[model samples]
Structure formats: C-alpha cells, structure tokens
Target: MVMFAIIPYLALSAALDPLAPIIAGQLHMSAQTMSLGSGLGNAAYALGTVLAVQLGLHLPQRRMLLAYAALLVVGSVLTAVAQNAAMFIAGHTVQGLATSMLLIAAVPPLAIGYPRERLHTTVMIMNMGIFGAVALGPFIGGLQADADAWRPLFWIVTAVAVLALLLVVLTFEDAPPANPDAPRDLPAIALAAAGSLAAFLGASELTSHSFLDVEVIAPLLGGLALIAGLIVYQYRAAQPLLMVREMLTSAIPVAGVVTALFAAAASVSATALTASVLSETYGPVRVGLLFLPELGGAVIAAGVFGLVIARRSLHYLPLVGMILLAAGILVFRLGMPDSQPLALLGSALTGLALGATVAPALFVAGFSLPSASLPRVFAVVELLRAVAAFMIAPIFAHFAATVTGDLNEGTNIALWIGLGLALAGAALGVTIYALSGARPQTPDLDTFLAGQRPAWYSPPLLSRLRRSHDLDDLDVALPVPESVD
Candidate 1:
C-alpha cells in the first residue's frame, strides 16, 4: 500500500523533466507555466509535512489518511485527463499535498509501531518503496518521451493511485488523535506555507529568468529568510509542532541531519545535470538505459540498510554513503557527458549513495530522540530535506547551464561542487562525532519502543569539549527524557 501510494508521485517527479516539453506543447502551455506548476506542487508537498503533523496531533488519523488517499485519486484522475494548464496544475498541486500528508501519516507508525524483530523488514520496505521509485523515474521518463506521449504514463500513474486508495480502504483501522491536548501551531503552518511558496516560486523562475532577476531573487530570498525564521520560531515555541530544538542540540541527530541535507542536495544534481548533458548525445531511451543501474544500486543499498538497522554499524552508514557519493561524482566527472559505461557505473554508485544516506540518517536522528517523538522529528527532517534537495536541484541545473558558455564545461563544474559537498558533509559528520564524544552503540530497541528513552545514547552537542565547571550552563540544552506509562 505504501509502495503504491508513494511510487507513482516520486517516479513521475523524476520523469516530469523528460515529459515536460511534450506536455507543455500539447496543452499550449509555456515553459514558464510548466515550471510554475511544478514549483507550486513541490511547495505544497513541503508545506504538507507540517500540516500532516499538526492534523495528526488533533484529528482522527486513520480517517484523515482515507481522505488524503481519496484526494490523491482525484488529483491523479484530473492530471491524467487534463486538457488545459489550470486543470493540470491544480491536479499536480493536490497530488503533492496529499502524498506528503500520507507520508507523515503512514511511515512513522510502521517505524515505531512494529515489534523489534520486524524493524529491519519495515525499514527496508520503506527504503525500497521510496528510493527505488525515485531511481526508476528517469527510465520511465525517457520511455515516455521516446514515445512522444505523456498521457499514457500519467494514466498508468492514475491506476497506481487508485490501487493505493483501495488499499487504504482495506487496511482501515480505528485510531484516535495522537495527542488531543497538543496545541495547534497555526503560526508554524503559515510560515511553512509562505516559505515553501516563495522559495519554490523563485526557483521555478530559473526556467526563464536569471537568479538575480527581481522575479527570482526577491521571493527566493524572502522564502529563505522565512525558512530560517521558521526554525527559530519552532525552537522557541511553547509547544513546537516539530522537534527542532531536541535534534539540533544533540550530537548524533545534528550529524545525521547535516549528512542528510548535503547528501540530498548533492545527489539530485548528480542525476539532473549529468542527465541533461547525456541528453545532448543520446536519445531519451538510451540515456534512460544508461541510468537503469541506478535502481539496482538503490535495491542493494536497501538490503544493506536492513542488515544494519538494529546494529552499531547503522551509525557509520551515512559516513560510508558520503564516501560512495564522492566516488560517484568522480566517476561522472571523469567521463562527463559522453562515456556510456561511465554513465552506467556513475548512476549506479550515486543511486547507492542516495539510498544509503538519507533514510539511514533519518533513522539515526530518530533513534537519538525518544520513540514517541519520532514522527515529529521526521516531519522536521523531511521539511528541511524537501527544501534543500528540491530547491538546490534547479539552482544547480541553472548554474550548470549558464555558468559557462559550454554546457559540458558547466556540468563538470557542477559535478566538482557536488563532490565537494559530499566530502564536506562527511567531514562535518565525523567532526561532530569526535568533538561530542559520541560512540556507536547498538540501539536499545526494547526501552526505545516503550517510549521511555532513545534507542541509543546521544550526547549534547559540543558537551565533551566543555569544562566540567561549565556543565551547569548546558544542562538546559539537554532534552528531558520521556517516560512511558
């Protein structure tokens, strides 16, 4: 059910790049219009994370899940049959909104609600469902473009959405609000909506305008500022919607988050910019074929993650992923846009790198916090990730296209920057572990599942470097441990 629910949207997100031209032409839409639709849809996705968390706190979660799935069906149907730009945009926007809502509603319970023995399987399935779909996207996109048709793929997507809705019906169970007494954070929701809209709006304009143009720069900067403001607002709120303060002040969670953000930002550019260059020399189908190994790599990574989820080795997974990511960038750089073998190998490695990094880092972060707080923790991590990955991809693509007169040269430059980010994220992660005196410990799932404490012990950030005399000042920075009744 989760697989069907998530795969269609994610795969299509990847495929959309290839299909955009055809769809735009057939619908009498301009490039700018298509870009705006995509951008707004992504903004809705980003905003939906916060809204989902808030709604879950005070509403009947299962009922809301049903509603979200139904809306997804409506969105998919509208998109599959759209004749005008407005219909397409509206449908896509709704799809994004509903997908994120379902994500928050579904994923965490599967993470925490299950028994200890099933944790690995649950995580592996989740990993494969999400990243595997993403890895498979380019190939699907390429196939659709090669056929010179977009509606067929969308119709297929609509079928999958329908399947997801039916599964929701079959799996329905009664569940009450998560915490009826939790305060409604309307300000946080507003900030998320505004920030996401502004940032994505600015980024989408890159399809036509310069980065510094008023149409692009003003909203982009304003959105960024708002995002920053959101972090601050959440950190200080009396009852925060997400676990910003808890994760930030802890060493492991901080390290995990940094790796996740940079890994996500770097990984998207790996495929997009390189694929753009590849498109110059190869047809859509051939380029897609070259990238097919990406999906295989993602599956392998999912298996490996399953093996290590409950072990001390999970702590090292993100670090190892970063190394693989850098090596993948090197592969793409050596061959640039021309070597078919290099494209095959580089895409696989990058697929592995991405599969290994983001989800594991999220779990690492989740394990550091109380089990009960996992959902809220996830909401914040995903919110940041959506911003970093989605926003950075367009910016990086634009930079690669415009930074140099030669497209190949510009792509090489972007690949190097990606390599740097991967290495830097790894370095920062290691430094945090060393400075905070964090050690890899097997997660205590028994206590963690009881919601009494974290799966592993995480030190306060920089606490090891502080003198014993100053310990009192940092005590307030520590999370008050939760206890299960």
Candidate 2:
C-alpha cells in the first residue's frame, strides 16, 4: 500500500525536474510556462487532500484506493503521450491530484493501525517513502535528461501506476469509513479548490508579469481572501470539514503546522532556486549529480528518526532539524557554488534538514491529536503545506529569473530570503518548545497538546526574573485554553 501510494509521485517528480529544460524546448514552452504546470499540479495535490477526506467519509477505503490508482494510470498515460504544453500540464495536474488523494487516504491508517512497538517502523517508512523518493528523483531525471528524452520516463511511471492498481486489488480490505453518514462539505471543497487554483495562477503569472500586475495581484489577493473566508466558515461550521477550532486552540498542533509550513517553503524554494541557477551553469546531468547527497542525507535522517522514536525523544527532533536547516540555508546564502563538491555538500545538508524536520513535525501533530481526528488534521496540514511549499516555488523562480536580469544574482537574493525563513522557523520551534514546557524524552502527546508542563519543567528565564523581583512566591502557571478532546 505504501509503495503503491508513494513511489509514482517520487518518480514523476524526479523525472520532471531534470528533464524540465528538455521538455520545455521540445514542447516550445518557456520555463515560466512549464512552472505553471508544476504549480497547478501541486495546487491540485493540495485541494485533493480535502476531496480525499470527504470521499473517505462516504466510500469504501480500498475501493477508493483502487479508483485513485486507476486514475493515476490514466494521468501518466496522458503525460507520456503529450505532444504539447497544454496536454502535458493537464496530465501532470491529474497525476498530482491522484497522488495526494492516495496519500491522505492511505497514510493515516498506516500511522495509527500499527502496533506501538512498530511505530518507529512506520516513521521510517514515511521518511523513506517521501524524502527518500525525492532524493532519488534527480538521478533518474538526470539520466533521462542527459539522453534528451522524457517519454520513456513517463512510460515507466505509467507502468508503476498499473502496478499500484494491481497491489490495491490484491491487498483489498474492508475497512469502514470513519463516519459513514458524514455530510459532504461542498462549500468547503469549492472554496479550497478555488483558493488554491487562484493562488497558484497568480504566482505562475509572476514568471511573465511583474508582481504588481493585475493578472498577478488580483487572483493572489482574492485567493487569500477566499481562504480566510474558508477558515472562518470552518471555525463556525456545526461539523467542520477540518478541525480548525481544535488546531487553533492546541499549542503543539499549531507549532507543528507552522514548522511544517515554513520548513517546506524554505526547503522547496531553496532547491528550485539553486537547481535553476546551477543547472544553467552546469548541464542537467552535473546539476543532478550535485544533489545526489540528498539521498544519503535522507537515509541518515531515517536512521536518526528511528533512534529518536525508540528513545521517545520526538519532541526535540524538530528543534534539532530546524537548527540543521538554518545551517544548510546559510551555506546557500554564502553562494550558489559552481563547484560540484560545494554544491553537493549544500544539497546534502539541506536534504538532511528536510528529512529530519518535516516528517517529524507531522508525527508530532499526529500524535497530538486522537487517532479518529487524524484524517482531518492531516488534510488541513497537507493543504497548507502544499500551498506554502509548491506555490512559493514559482514565485521564487520568477524573481530569480527577473530580479537583476542575472540568474545568479537573483538566486542569491532568493537564497538570502530563504535563509531568513529558515532562521525564523528555527526561532519559532524554540519558542514553541519553551512555552509548551516540552522535554526531550517526553512520550505523552496529550501533555504537550494540553500545555501541561512536565514535572521537571521550570520556566528558567521567567523563574530567575521572578526571583530577582522578589515575586517568586506568586503562582505563575501559564494558562492553556481548553481544546477539543
């Protein structure tokens, strides 16, 4: 189930990236136009999460998985045979949507259904499924790109989708919906889809139009407004599509979401920018080689995550990850090196940061909520993350192409901004840890969400200040708002 759900997306992502230049040239499209397809595809991925949750409410899980896999096969076929930009974009968009639907539908069960002793195995699987595939993407794409061919890669993906369909049929099970009678949230779905499409369209426009262009600004602002409206509506809905109120009121979940959002944005933007700059100076193959270290880093992170989970030190893992990410971003800030060795090192560090942080943050959020609430939680987090990570890439890419009319200069500017975001994410992780009074080895998810300080916790700075002011005798417990159980 895991391989069926994850491998195709990773393979497709890997193939598309290195082959992008060749694909663009062959199809008579500009880089920005190509980016539009990727942007929309990712937007579909984000919106599909909502649809998956809604469908899961009304359909048999295994049947739905089969349907999604079948659609993926169709999508891959479209991409493989595409002869024009429009056809390619349409196919890739379908691929993205199906992948996300499969993801939200499949992964939560794997996370929660397994035995407690095997939770680490689940984490390792997730790490490998996601980051591991991403790490391998460049090598596969580079080979195809170096040969100046893309159809073969798409054909390969089509075969994998077919394999996934077979797996779904063979492994079919009869798991009931979480809420068989749950009403479809059409309004929420429409709003989410419209918002994601508009936002991505707006960002894609930046590639050809200035940031202030009406084509760019209106849809972007309108998209954000619609999303804000969705949040307000969800907060007040009788039976919300997502647990907005609960997430808003919980400390750990909020922290986890923020960490995931910023980390994704920073990491993805950096990779896109660096790849564009370096790939131009060096051929696609060398650029792909530069990122091979990411695969190594992801493997290392999976091992580290296994150790952390075994020791019940999940709470501190994000902090460690953010620190590494900050250091990695700083490496890029120094320069986007033409040197292969330097570029390899930078990619490895950043990949390690991504593997260490994003998945662990997700686990933190998952554990913080009850198993029953995970679908909604995962849906909302994936929605926001897709927006932040995928949408931001085109915008950053656009600026990198146009900022000073020098790609290298534009890339440096983007890297500096990415560095700032990484540092800010690290700072936020620290604040969440300190304010929540979470410990390194803590295993109680509820305690963190409830904002209950561990027995050994003391507000180090606050306590010292209080003693200095002779106010240490007064009670100083931080208040935690009541959250949905």
Candidate 3:
C-alpha cells in the first residue's frame, strides 16, 4: 500500500524531468511553458499539505486515502491524454496535489502507530519512499526519453494510481480524526495555495520574460507578501492551522525545517540545471545514465540512518548530510558542463546528502513533538519543503537557460547559486546543533522531547539574543513521555 501510494510521484517526476524537451516539442510548447507546468504541479504538491491536514482533522482516514487515490487516477489519465500545455499542466497539477495529500494522510500513522523497535524500519521506508523513488526517476525518465514518447509513462502511472486505490480499499480500516471538531483554517489554505501559485507563475514567466517584467515581478512580490502574512497569521491564531509557533520555538525543529527547505532548493535546482545542460549536449539516455550513482548513494545513506536513528549521534546526522550536500554542489559548480565524471560524482553525493539529511531531520522534528502533534508537524514541514524545493526548479531552469547567451555559462551561474544555498544550509544545521546543545552521543527519545537546554545555551551570545527577542516566552512544555514499546 505504501509503495503504491508513494511511487507514482517519483515515477511521474522521473519520467517528466528527462523528457521535458520531448514533451515540449510534441505539444508545440516552449521550455518555459513546460517549466511553468512543472512548477505549478510541484507548487500544488506543496500546498496540498494544508488540505491534507484539514481533511485529516474532519474526515475518516481510510476513506480520504481512497479518495486521494481516485483523484490520482483521474489526474494521471488527464496527463496521459493531454493534447495541449494547459491540459498537461492541469493534469500534472492534480497528480501533484493528490500525491501529497495521500502522503500526509497515510505516512504519519505508520510513523506514530508503529512500535519503537520498528522505527528503523519506518525510517527505511521513508527513505525509500522519498529518495529511492527520486533516485529511480532519472533512469525511468531516460528510458522513456530514449523511446521518444511520454504517453506510455503516463499510462503506467495511471495503472499505479489504480493499484494504490485498490490497495486502500482492500486494506481499509476505520480511524477517527485526531480532532473531529477542529475548526477549519480556510485563510491558511487560501494563502498557501495562492502564494504558491503566484510565486511559481512568476518564476515560470522568467523564461520568456525578463525578471523585471510585471508578469515576473508582481506575482513574485505579491506571493511572497501573502506568504509572509500567512506566517504572521499562523503565529497569532489560537488554533493555528500549521503550528507555526511550535516550530519557531524549538531549535531542533527550526533547524530541521531550514535544512529541509534549503537542501531541497539547492539540490532540486542543481539537478534541473545540470539535467537541462547535459541532456541537450549528450542526449537524455546518457544524462540519465550519469545519475544512476544517486541510487547507490541513497541506499548507503539509508543504511547509515537506520544504524544511528535511535542513538544520540542522530542529532549530528543532518549536519553531516548538509556538509555532504554542500560538497556535492561544489562538485557541480567546479566541473559542470565539461566533466561527466565530476557531474556523476556530484549526483551521487547530492543523492546521499538528501537521503542523509531530509528524512533524519523529519524524524528529529517528529520526535521533538508529542505523538498527537505529529501529523500537524509533518504537514507544516512538508508544506514549507515543497514550496522551497520544488518551486525553485523552474526559476533555476530559466536562469540556466537564459542568464547569459551561452547556455553552459548560464548553467554555471545557476550552479553557483545552488552552491551558496547548500553552504548556507550546512551552516544553519551547525547553528541548530550548537543552539540546542545536542551531543555527539545519541540521547534517548525522552531526553530529546524534554527540550533540554544545552550548557552553552546561556552563553553571552545566545542570552543576549534570547533577551532581545524574549524567546523564552515561546518555550513549550514537553508532554508526558509515552512508552515507546
């Protein structure tokens, strides 16, 4: 069931990424138009987190999963039969939205409901579900691109969606909502969707129009402003939709969110840029072959995560992952467009970094909160992650294509930006570890959830910052620990 629910997103992404050019040519669309479709689809995926959470609060879990699966089938069919760019975008958007909704609705129960001894298995499942699928994307995309057709891939996805729907029906089990009477946060959903749409639309326009053009500037700025408002509103609402206050108050959770966002943005953008440059130069099959090492890297990282997940060293995992991610970006910045071996090495390293960091950070966030809050935490984190990671790809693609007259030079420039984001993310992870006073040794889940302040937490630098911002007031009491077994 889990495999069926999650693999479709990976299949679609992998198929679309390498085949973007083919799809564009077949539909008589520009690369920018294709990017717009991809960007909007991803944005819908990100924003759908809110909808998933809302529905989870009010709807029966199994029924919602089934509904989401049905929507996935419809979306995949629409994409398969799409005759124009608009139809394609609409279909892809629905696929993206439905996939995320299913993810948020289904995954948390597995994470929280399972026994503590089984957590390693849960983490492995997450790594495979997210990164494993991503690792396979290029291979699948390359094969289809080599075949010069996309409808077959879409048809396969339609079948997968159907399988997922059937799995939901066969495995049906009734589960009550976490809070059946929780009021819906309509404003949060509206802002999230609108902000994501506008931002992605603006970024997509950058392909055909200059960054200064109103089409690019207005939506970009307006969307950012709306998102800012959503944050403030979430912070103040007594029953916030996304638990913004809880995230902000905790050092570990803040770091996890930042790591997820920045790492995703950097890695996804780099992949898009490199794939674009390489596919044009060497063809899609060869380019896809180049990225096969990522699967190995993701597998190795997942193994490492399984080993350290229950130990205190888990705190340091994200930091190490971020460092690796930065190194990967550097590899691309230094050797892209001219060095295939270096690019392959970079791909493997980035894949390892992703497998190492994002999921571990998610685990950190989940453990930081009580079990009851797990769904909300996952929803909020995934929302921000989608916005940061997926939204940036099209913008990076636009820049790589047009930042300069030379495509290689343009890609190089974008790689530099990605490198900066990677380094920044690494530094943020370090800050989080330092601020939280997480030890190199692994602490028990209870110690972590207690929000223990580090010895250095009261040092002059932090004390002054805490005083200035009155951060102490935001501290939340740890819930009574629940027995894991």
User: What are the per-model C-alpha RMSD values against the true structure?
Assistant: 6.3, 6.6, 7.8
Instruction: Give the deviation of candidate 2 from the true structure as CA RMSD.
Output: 6.6
Return the lDDT, model 2, position 121.
78
Model 3 error, position 102 (Å): 0.8
Clash counts per candidate, in order, are 0, 0, 5
Tens digits of per-residue lDDT, candidate 3, 1-485, equal: 76787788766776577788889999888988897898788778878888898898888877888899999888989989999988898999999999889888888777656656787887786786669788878888999988988889888888988998898899898887768889999999999889888887887787788878999989988887887788889989999978788777766677778888888888865577887777767877788888888888888899889888888777778878888888887887777675899988988998899899898888776666665677788888888787777667767776777678788888888888887888898887677657555434453544333334221121232234566456555444445678998
Q: Using Cα atoms with residue i matched to residue i, what is each candidate's TM-score against the true structure?
A: 0.96, 0.89, 0.89
Model 1 per-residue lDDT tens digits across residues 399-429: 9989987889999999999999999999999
Candidate 1 TM-score, C-alpha based? 0.96
Best by TM-score: 1
Model 2 C-alpha lDDT per residue in residues 373-482, reported as the tens digit of each score: 77788898888888888778777877877889988888888888887888888788667656655445455534432435321222232233445556534445545569
- lDDT: worst 10-residue window of model 3: 453-462
Off by over 4 Å in 2: 28-32, 436-441, 444-485
- Candidates ranked by TM-score: 1, 3, 2
Residue 209, model 2: Cα distance from true site in angstroms: 1.3
Scored against the true structure, residue 42 in model 2 reaches a CA lDDT of: 77
lDDT of 3: 0.79
